[model samples]
Target: MRRYGQAVLMLLVGAAVLRISLFSALYLRYVQSGLRPYLIASGALLVLLGVAAGVRAAREVPDEDETQDPHEHGHTHTTGPRLAWLLALPAAALLLFPPPALGSYSADREDAQRAAQGIGTFPPLPSGDPVDLSVAAFTSRAVYDSDRSLKGRTVRLTGFVTHGDDGTWYITRLLVSCCAADATTSKVEVRGADAPATDTWVTATGIWHPKGRLGSSAAWPPLLDAKAVRRVEEPSNPYEQR
Candidate 1:
């Protein structure tokens, strides 16, 4: 029973290594921020326990002249020594070069745009405080009906990317409720000299101008006179704050 347990534990470690290597993006999607540290700690503890059990099993052997044959002793041979190093390779890659958040690669994918989904009407902005409407909300309204409620009002939004198909540029942003797996792209297309470079974070202050269409996908409000377009670092939580 002990030998069987040790074999199962080793196989689990091997599987974990492969998951962290080829499917890191998938792993990141499911594991939330604080949960990651706990996973790492638990994994380390299991690995150490397995190692100890393996060492003990290696030291136990039947006497040569026992009543039963030595080969019949309750030990199962394992090829663990040959495969144990594979367990460390994934960790090494992450330590040396961590991957960037899923960005432009997903942006160009047709399924990434949320405008194709239904649009909703946003209430009027309050008199003093800046109104915070999601890129999804803004795009939905404009796509369904250009002359909806989001016109001629000053708005504030944050996102990455600052270019458009019509030679004009924008300060685009994405709203991600969870991880990158479910991220939906939405942008406040701004056209002006102060437009930042691609992928640069910017907080844009401008009025929504419902004029042009985003290819065949949907119509969006354009920024006529952007008051400010200052570049800022990407937020820790890259997804849209729900």
Candidate 2:
């Protein structure tokens, strides 16, 4: 049993990743949904390998006498570096604490110079009052469409709060082309309503602020003059797919 302790630890960690990725939503925080199957497959394989190593270690008989072709008992049966066992600690952290989609914590750390996605001439807003929009779609229209595509239009935007330096806050969401690693901010400076705590999810109904100069490619998304602000639950899939 002692001989296979490290192998058992590996098996537990691999099982953890597989369990969380399959049974929980945190997997969406680290990677895209399309990659879920691959993670499950890979985790399963690692677990099987660990089990095999444990079985092999248990089957090996210790040399009874040091003089009878003996070496250190632990080294003789254990074929892998002990240091490799430490990798399991970080892998297990995910299971210890639930990982939600990137929230205010991640958004605040993001570079202000990151470019907005979906930039270009925007099509006319589909006819309606209080049109629903993704953070990316709203940001592009607000930033690039100079004729005020969003002017006088009522809109609903859902996002977490990114506390800003100027005492205001950004209603923010990350736009991921493939995964969170490649995500960029698509935020709007929200005015009129009190800023919510960082990472707190909320739905805001608002009209666009029509005056700020759209900065360079790396500029922040345009501001929204919010009509209402209220707390809400985080969406099941939080990142905006670009």
How do the predictions measure up, each by TM-score?
Answer: 0.61, 0.82
Mind giving the per-residue lDDT tens digits that candidate 1 earns over 33-108? 5455555656566667667777776677733543455467776446565465565565555444556666645664
Q: Residue 178's C-alpha lDDT in candidate 2?
A: 85
Q: Lowest summed-lDDT stretch of 10 residues in model 1?
A: 21-30
Which one wins on TM-score?
2
Enumerate clash totals for all models, in the order shown.
2, 0
Give the per-residue lDDT digits (tens) of candidate 2, residues 107-141.
Answer: 77766563443345667888998999998888777
What lDDT score goes with residue 197 in model 2? 85
* Residue 4 lDDT, candidate 1, scale 0-100: 38
TM-score of 2: 0.82
